[model samples]
Target: MTVVDVPGSKSLTARALFLAAAADGVSTLRRPLASEDTEGFAAGLTALGYRVERTPERWSVQGSPAGPPHDTAEVYCRDGATTARFLPTLTAAGHGTYRFDASAQMRRRPVAPLTRALRALGVDVRHEESEGHHPLTVTADGVRGGELALDAGESSQYLTALLLLGPLTRDGLRITVTRLVSAPYVGITIAMMRAFGVTVSRENTSRGEVFSVPPGGYRAADYAIEPDASTASYFFAAAALTGHETTVPGLGRGALQGDLRFVDVLERMGARVRVDDDRTTVSGTGTLRGITVGMRDVSDTMPTLAAIAPYASGPVRIEDVGNTRVKECDRLAACAENLRALGVSVTTGEDWIEVSPGTPRPARIATRADHRIAMSFAVASLRTPGITFDDPGCVRKTFPAFHEVFARTRAAWGLAAAASPDR
Candidate 1:
C-alpha cells in the first residue's frame, strides 16, 4: 500500500490568485500549489502591486479592488500558460500600461485569441515583435466589457481569462463562446468564481455557450484548494500498473478540479476505485483492460493514460484531444513518439491517438520540456525498467517534489511487499 498526499490544484491556485488579487479584501488560500508555474503567477501579481505572502501552511493575498496599483509594470510569466494568458486579461482590467514577457517555451504559444477578444472589449493590446505571441504591451484604462465573441479553439484559458474578468468590467460581460476546446475547465473557472462570491450564468446556445457575468466585483474569502488530480493520476496509474492500492488524500467526489474525472476513466479501464468525501482510493485488479475515451474535458491526463496503454489487455484510443498539440508541447505527438520509443504500437491522427499492447523496451523519452510528459513517463518506469527521460527536471513546472515523493511511495510499497508473507 502506498498512500500519498498530493499537493493543491494548479488550476485552482491560478484562478484563486487572479480572483484574490481582484478582490475587495485580504484572501487566504489554504494548501495552494507551490510550483514554478503557480509561484510565477503569484510573482507576476506581486509585480502589479498585489501583496501575496506565502507562509508554511498557506498563502495570504491582500486585494486591490480599485485595480492594480502600478501604472507601468513589466511582468514575466515563465512557462505557465495559464499565467501568461490570464495575467494579460487581469492587466487589461486595470488602469495601467503593462508589458508582459515569457520564457523561451511560453513564447511559442498562442495569445492572439485572448488579445483579439480584449481589443473587442476596448483594450489596447499590442505585440512588440511577434504577433499573437508573448512580449507584448497592454494599455488599459479599465475594460468596458459588453457582449463579446471569441474562439477558444486553441485553449480554454482564453475563455477562462474573459470569465474571470467579466464581473470587473464596467457593464459586466456577455461572452458568447464561439468554439470551446476544453469545456470542463470552464466549469472549474465557474466554480472558483462562485466561491469568491460572483455568479456567472452559463447557457447552451446555438453557437456554443454564452456566459453572462454580473457587474459586481469579487469578494475576498478563505479558500481551500483541492489536491491536484492531474498530478494524482500518476500515482493512481501506478496502482493500476502494480497490483497494489494507492490512495490520494484530499480529493474525492466533491473535488472542484476537472482532472479528477480521470479516475472515472480508470474505473472504466478495470481498476477498482473508492471515492468518499475525504479521499480517493484506487486498487489494481491484477490486470488492466483498455477502453476508448474522449479526453477533451480531462485531456491533461492523456499522456498518463497513454503510458499505461502498453500494459493493458487491449488497445487504448483517446479522442477529442486536438488541443493536446498546442499545450506545453505537442503532447499527442510526444506521447506517440515516446510510446513508439518503448516499442509500443501507437497510431495518431489530428485529434486522436490509439495505443496497442507491446513489449516496452529500454528507451530515453524526450520530454520536450513538458511537465506532464516527464511525469507520465516516470509512471511508466514503475512497471518497466530502462525508461529514461530527456528532461526529468521539467516536473518542477507543476510538482517540484514529484520525484522525491514518488521515490518515497515506491519505498513504502517495497516495504509493504517485503513484509507480506504471500510475497
Candidate 2:
C-alpha cells in the first residue's frame, strides 16, 4: 500500500484562523495548510490589524476579542469564499470602517445571505458596486447581538459567520436558521468554537434550528489541523481508477470535515475502504459501480466523483447539490461540459448531473481557475491518456504542489498520467 500525506484541511484552517484571531490570548495552530486561500485569510486578519506570525510548520495569531485593532482597513480577499464572507463578519465585532473586495470569481459567488444577516443585526454593511456583492463596506459600531433569523440555503458560511460572531457580541446571540446547506460545516464551527472555550447550544425548534451562543469571549488554545479530506478525494479517486491501494494518513474515525465521508461514497462505488484510528485506505477491486447519490452535504466532492464517473459500469447520478452552482464556478455544468469534451455521455440539471458509462477520450479540461476542478479532473486523467488541464496551477489555492504530489503518487503506483504539465 502506498501512503499519501495530504495537506491540512482548508475548512479547518480557515475556521481555526478566525477562532485564533478572535480568541482572548495568543493562539497557535500546528500544521496549518499553507496555500492561497489560507494565506489570504491570515493576510485579511493582518489587514484588520491583528498580529499573525507564520512559519513553515505552524501559525501563531495574537487574538483580540474586542475586534480588530485598526479603525479602518481595506482587505482584498483573494479567490477564497471563506475569506470574503467570514472576514467581513469578523470586522463587524470591531469598531472600524472596513472595506472588503475579492477576485472576479469570488465577487460572482453570492454573499447576500450573510450580508443580509449582518445588516439585520444593526451593522452598517453596504455593497459599493452591486447589492449583496463584494466591494462592500462595513461601518462597525460593535454588534449588540440579540435574536435573529437567517436563510443559508446557498451557502453555510452565513450561519457560520453568525455563529463565530456570537461570542464577540455584547448580549450574545440567538440565531434561528430557516434553511441550511452543508450542515456538517456548521458542526465543524461549533466544535472549533468549543475548542476556543465557547459553547454554542443548538436544537430543533418550530421556527427552525436554533443556536444559542453565550456572551463570554473565547480563550486561546493550541490546536492541530487535520489533513484535508477533500484533497485526499483526488488521491482516493486515483486508486479507484487504477485498481491500486492508497492510504492517506491523518484522517480517521474522528475526523471533523464532512468531506471525509467521501470514503463512504467510494465504498458505495465498489471500492474497498478501511478507516482506522490514524489513517484511511481505499483499494480498488477493479470494478467501479455507478451510483445515484444525494450530495447536498458533501457537494465539494461532487466534482471528484463526477470526474471518475465515466469509469463506472452503469450510470452515475449526483443529486441535491444545487449549492454547487454558486461555488468557485458552476460545478455541475463544468463537470458535464468537461466530461462531454472527453466524448463521454452526460446530462445535467440545475442541481444534478448523470454520467453514463463510457470510455473518456483525450481532451483538454477547462479548469476555470478553480482548484477543485483542476484536481478532480486530474483523477480522470489517470485513466484517459492525453487529458490535460487549461490551468493546472490553480491547485495552488489549496494544494500548491498538487501536480507534483499526483505525479509522484502515479509513478509510485506504476500508473501513467497526463493531466497537469508536471505529469
Candidate 3:
C-alpha cells in the first residue's frame, strides 16, 4: 500500500482568493494550491490593488473594503480559464476600468457567456477584439443587480463568477441559470460562499435554477482548502492499473470537490473503495470492468478513466462532457487521439467517448499542454512499458512536481522503472 499527500484544491484556491480579496477584512487560506493557474489569479488580484501576502504554508489576502482601488488595471490570465472568467465579474463588482486578457491558448476558449451576463447585469463591458471572447475591457460602475438570466452551458465558471459577486450588487441579485453545465461546481461555489459567511439561496423554479443572493457582504474568516480530488484521481487510477492498494490522505467522503465522485466511477469499474473522514483508499481487484457514465459534473477525471479503460474487461463509455472540448485543448479529441496512439480502440462524438479493451502498446503520448492529459496517461504507463510523454512538464500548471511525486510513489510500489526519466 502506498499513501500520497496530494496538493490543495485548485478550484477551492481560486474561489477562496476571489472571496477573500472581496470580503470585509483580512482572510487567511491554508495549504492553497501554488501553481501557474493560481499564481495567475493572485497576480490579477494584486493588479486590481488587492494586497496578497504569500508564505510557504499559507496565504493572507487583505480585503478591499471599497473594492479594488485601481481605476484602470490590465489583468493577464495566462492559460487559466477560471482566472479569466472569474476576474472580470470580480472586477465589475467594483467601480473600475479594467482590461482582461489571457494567453494564446486561453484566448481561444469562450468567455462570452460570462461577459454577456455581466453586460446584462449593467456593467460597461466591451469585447475589444472578439464578440464573446477575451481581450475585453470593463468600464465598471458596479453591477446594478436585479433579476438577470444567462446561459452557462459552455463553462460553469460563468455561473460561479456571477454568484461570487452576487452579494455586492446594488439591489442584491437573483440570477436564473438558463442553461447549466457542470452543476456540481455550482454546489462548490455555494458551499464556499457559505464558508465565508454569506448565504446563497438556490431554488428550482419553472424558469430555471434561481440563485437569490441578498445584498449582504462577506465576513472574512480563516479557511483551509482540501486536497484536490482531481489530482487524487491520477493516483487512484494508479492502483487500478497496477492492482495495488493506494490511499490518499486529507480527502474522503466529506470532500468538498465534486471530482471525488470519480471514486464512484472507479468502484463501478470493480475497484474496492473505502472512504473515511480523513482519507480515502482504493484497492484494486486485479481486474477492471467497463461501464457507461455521464461525466459532465466530474469531467476533469474523464482522461483518467479513459487511460484505465484499456485494462477493462469490455468497452467503457463516457458521455455528457462536451464542455471539455473548449478546455486547454480539445480534450475529447485529445483523449481519442492519445488512446488510439496507445493502441486502444476509441470513438468519440460531440460529448461522448467509448474505449474498448486492448493491449496498450508503448507509445509517446502528446499531452497538448494539458495537465490532466499528462497526469492521466502517466497512470497507463504503470501497466505498460515504454509509455512516455512528450509534454510532461505541462503538469506544472497544476501539479508542478507531478513526475517526481509519481516517481516516488511508483518506486514505493517496487515499480522503479515505471516512471524513470531515462525511459
Candidate 4:
C-alpha cells in the first residue's frame, strides 16, 4: 500500500484566516495549506492591518472583533475566488474604504450576488468597472444584519461569504437561498464558524432554506485544518486506474470537506474503498466500472472522474455540474476536448458530460491554467504514458509540491505492485 500525505484544505485554510481575524482573541492554525490562493488570503488579511504570522507548518493570527484597523486599504486577490469574495465581505463590518481586485481570470468570474446582498444590508459597494465584477470597493460603517435573499446557483462562495459575516453584524443575518449549488461547501463554512465559537442555524421555509447566524462574534482557539480531499481525488483515482492500493491519511469518516465523498465514486467504479475514522483507503479491484453520478455537491472531482472514465467498461456520465461552466475554465468543455485528443469518444451538455470507454492515446493536455485540469489528467498518465500538460506548474494554486509528491507516490506504488504482483 502507498500512503500519501496531502496538504491541508484550502477551503478550511481560507475560512480559518477569516475566522481568526474576526475572533475575540488570538488564533493559531495548524497544518494550513501553503499555496498561491491561501497565501494570497493571508496577504489580504495583512493588508487590512490584521497581524498574521506564518511559518513552515503553522500560521497564527491576532483577531480584531471591531474589524480592520486600517481605514483605507487596497488588496489584490490573485486567482482565489474566496479571497476576492470573502475578503471584501469581511471588510464590510469595519469602518473603512477597502478596494478589492483579483487576477484577470478571477475578475471575469461573478461576484454580483455577494455584493448585492452586502448592499441590501445597508453597506456601500461600488464597482470600479463592471457592475457585477471585481475591481470593487466596500465602504463600511458596520453591518446591522437582517432578513435577506440570495441566489447561489452560479457559485457557493457568495453564500459562504455572508455566512461568515453573520456573527460580525449587529442583529446577525438570516439568509434565504433561492438556488444553491455546492451546498456542502456552505456546511464547511458553518462547521468552521462553530469551531470559532459561533453556531449558524438552518431551516426550510416557504421561500427557501433560511440560514440564521447569531451575533456575538467568534472566539479564538488553536484550530487544526484537515487534509484537502479534492486534492486527494487524483491519487485515489490513480490507484483505481492502475490496480494499486493507496491510502491518504487525515481525510476519514469525520473529515469535514464534502469532496472526500469522491471515494464513493471510486467504489462505484469497482474499486475497494475502506473508510475509517482516521483514514480512508482505495484499492483497485483490477477492473474499472463506468458510472453515472450527480456531482452537484462534489463537482471539484468531476475532472478526476472524467480523466479516468475512458478506462471504465461502460460510459461514465457526470451530471448536475452546471456551475462548472464559470469555474477556472469551462471544465466540461475542457474534459471533452482532452478526452478527444486522447482518441476517446466524449459528449458534453451545459451541465453534464458522458465519456465512453476506449484506449486513450498519449497527447499533450491543455490545462487552461486550471490546477484541477492538470491534476486530473495526471492520473490518466499513469496508464497512458507520454501524456503531458500544456502548463505543468499550474498546480501551485493548491499543491505547490504536487508533481514531486505524485512522482514519489507513483514510484512507491510501482515497487509495491512489483513486490506482490498477484495482490
Best by TM-score: 2
Candidate 2 or 4, higher TM-score?
A: 2
Model 4, span 173-267: residue lDDT tens = 99999999998999999999999999999999899999999999999989999999999999999999999999999889999999999999999
Clashing pairs in 2: none
User: How do the residues 147-230 of candidate 1 rate in per-residue lDDT, one tens digit apiece?
Assistant: 989899889999999999998898999989888877788999999999999999989899778999998899998999888999
375 Cα displacement, candidate 1 (Å): 0.6
Off by over 4 Å in 4: 415-423
Give the winner by TM-score: 3 or 4: 3
Give stretches of model 1 more than 4 Å off: 415-423
Error of 4 at 382 (Å): 0.4
The positional error of residue 268 in candidate 1, measured at the CA in angstroms, is 1.5
Which segments of model 2 are wrong by more than 4 Å?
A: 417-423
Alpha-carbon deviation at 129 in model 4, angstroms: 1.3
Candidate 3 lDDT over residue span 161-221, tens digit each: 9889888787888989888888888899999999998899988989898999987778897
Candidate 2 residues 363-414, lDDT tens each? 9889888899989988888888788877888899999999899889989988
Residue-level lDDT for 326 in candidate 2: 93
Error of 4 at 165 (Å): 0.2
Count clashing residue pairs per candidate.
0, 0, 0, 0
